[model samples]
Target: MAPRNKEQEAEVLSWIFEVLGEKVPSGQYEDILKDGIVLCKLINKIAPGSVKKIQERGTNFQLMENVQRFQAAIKKYGVPEEEIFQTADLFERRNIPQVTLCLYCLGRITQKHPEYTGPGLGPKMADKNERTFTEEQLRAHEGELNLQMGFNKGASQSGHGGFGNSRHM
Candidate 1:
């Protein structure tokens, strides 16, 4: 095996020390030792603050310590992991700022989600107004109205109202 470079060793030591500092209580030597054992278990390497490497190889003492710590923390505190994560996620969801829309895709002013913009009949078309008219009745009514309005006489360049040719355009 190649000898460890000074810079790489320093970086790894710094990381281990940082993790130890976070995990261990200040002025507690035994807790510091436990942290070192956990770190050694983590990397399968030399324990920090020890003259010798720990001999218990392949055992997950680091993960075991973490589990013990987690259990202790939950016992001491009233909060669970699900509670914490759900609270954080709900905060992020509710904190999203509302935006104003300028011109809609249908060339009208409307509110919409940020990403989508296209020609649509919009929500008014989706609402059931309880007005019942069969297709045949609607067609006959429309044809009568068009004939009465002299739409077929070629007098008016604009056609009688229905769906119109805007969909084709």
Candidate 2:
């Protein structure tokens, strides 16, 4: 199916979050569980291949169609129950505490995995301020900046160089 346009997408997303925040409101519990599934799918879309990994590693999640091996593998790998249960807890439970934990863990997992490095989700950059700059690199960058701005103090003083709009008061 073709994707929804931006306005439609915004409305749907807004509805989901607003409904999820409700406490024992007019909705059915079963419907809420279905909403959780939709939310899980959206999260998977954001971090591709995550649903498969979650199935394989999310130990406490109980949807057992083709998940037998993952159940075994998760235990074998010694991944904690808490680590594995984010998706399931979000879908199956939908409690506020579980939802909070699931979102936190999902963010952590996506940040840790290399395949999730896309767009704004790229691997964290080390602070440039924390890194030591060699004098040669510093000089090169300075020269590049000067060239970028077409700046030359000596040429300017000789009155033969300018932005052509440099007015002296």
Candidate 3:
């Protein structure tokens, strides 16, 4: 496959976001991991089977095997292992930050591997909305927020648990 042109890349991103929008917490793109099956399918469409085995491994009887397969694929495919592990770790917790990290990892893959991206469509393009976050608006409570933003600071990835009454994997 050829690397996607801007138009083609945009379309693929749109489709992924559209699917994610419906499958996840409405407009919450970060919550993509909350519905791992759907996100895995979309990721597979772009990366070709990179995560298919992961969906099956998510449940009982093969957690370790599934973890290994998932780790291997991400490591081999150039995704940052830190982000991938963060996705699962956060996923088990079902918190907002985990969703954020998951989106980042998937976005990095599609952006980096344009050849594997989708071909362009005619004129029917993805929807668009615009918003701006200034330095202050985007980064309030700078000190505390920074400390709590990553995969580890807020929760332990060792088991499934959610913060405050948030969703639980």
Candidate 4:
């Protein structure tokens, strides 16, 4: 590939750092990088719009299903909700790249510690038959959200919020 200009390079590096903080400790860069790629792929499957969103945001951070899911999981699992909440916050704020990373972490936790089932067993328990979040499906969701958000933005920007001017109250 051709070498990126300074601006382009800076942007990429900035995104990397934004998603992976310095305090993440040393010796984990490889795993983090690997996980990031896997997650990007998974999320591309689950919600390609999230991928476009990360791109649109001009950052590498990954957006997942949403924090509410995790919050619910914490309640169900009876684990320390604070930890999950904080993690979800990081992903929501795009401080981390990809929300699936958090889910992966949670999945591992549940596996390693049976006591930690997370907040919502329903979603987790949904059999393999229902868990087909392919990249194509995600692309559809992205398209829908994009259209909705675009319409909202346009409508709002149009001044009267989609409705024409109103006479008397």
Candidate 5:
């Protein structure tokens, strides 16, 4: 189990509730999200119908299904596989921090969807800044040394001794 951050946990909880437009339930973070109902609802809110069936009340396996479903839905919605937390992380309370991280990542991914105008969490994602150059312009720079790389100004190592040689006084 990784070390938990109360502040980060609180922020994630607040963001989730804000997005879902619900009050934070009185309970531990893991307990509140263990059943995966809230997680399912969160993904649905971000991308409607992402989770087709949310098992509201059921046995452990069935409930874990909800977490799995949430994971799949978020993956489809653009959360990277690596960033998605395992079901046990939340359901088994093995790594609550990872679960929190997954939620934060989901919140961050929301910025990618223009239709999602709901509250956002974390720093706003930077927009893509793609620069296109003409063929001539690209060719023009082929032989030129990019100043950004470094302005060597015809530097050389003529005075420097090779490796293993000591410098003279």
Candidate 6:
């Protein structure tokens, strides 16, 4: 498991509580979110009716289903698949940092929905700036080598010893 950041986890918790219109409580982050109820509530708050039925009290499998539902809803709401955390990450306490990262991504993705005017989590997401180019403009740079590719300037390792041998002056 990766090292967990207390500050980031606190921030995500605060954001979740704020979105749910509940007061932030001083408690274990994983324990608070283990049941996945808060997660479902958070996503539903962002996107109403995203999760049709949230199992309030049930077996472990039912609770895990809530996490899965939240995952699917977030993916449908534009959160990237790679950014979403697995059920075990939150439930089994496998990787809390990943869970925090997933929440942060969910908060950042809220910018995609203009209707979401609630409290945000991390830095504001940048809007897409697309620039179109004409065919002539693209062809002009086809034969030209990009400077970012690095200029070797005819330098080569012709005199260098094979492998790790030291070169004597």
lDDT of each: 0.32, 0.42, 0.50, 0.37, 0.91, 0.92
Model 5 worst lDDT window (10 residues)? 150-159
Residue 118's lDDT in candidate 6: 92
Per candidate, the number of residue pairs that clash is 0, 0, 0, 12, 0, 0
| Top TM-score prediction, candidate number | 5
Tens digit per residue, CA lDDT, model 1, 68-92: 4422333233323332222111122
Give per-residue CA lDDT, model 4, range 13-114, as digits (tens).
333443333233334333343323433433333323333322212233332332333344434543344434343334434333333334434343444344
How many residue pairs of model 2 clash at the backbone? 0
Q: What's the candidate order when arranged by decreasing TM-score?
A: 5, 6, 3, 2, 4, 1
Q: For model 6, give the 10-residue run with minimal summed lDDT.
A: 144-153
Q: Identify the candidate with maximal lDDT.
A: 6
How much does candidate 1 score in TM-score?
A: 0.17
lDDT-better candidate, 1 vs 3? 3
TM-score between candidate 5 and the true structure: 0.82
Segments of candidate 2 deviating more than 4 angstroms: 1-35, 46-79, 84-94, 118-169
Better-scoring candidate (lDDT), 1 or 2: 2
TM-score of each: 0.17, 0.30, 0.40, 0.22, 0.82, 0.79
Ten contiguous residues minimizing lDDT sum, candidate 2: 65-74
- Candidate 6, residues 1-169: lDDT per residue as tens digits? 6799999988899999999999987779998999889999999999999999999999999999999999999999999999999899989998889999999999999987899989998998887899999999989987988867986778877889898899978
Model 6, residue 13: displacement in angstroms? 0.5
Cα deviation at 150, candidate 5, in Å, is: 12
Ranking by lDDT: 6, 5, 3, 2, 4, 1
* Candidate no. 2 TM-score: 0.30
RMSD of 2: 14.5
- Residue 118 error for model 5, in Å? 0.5
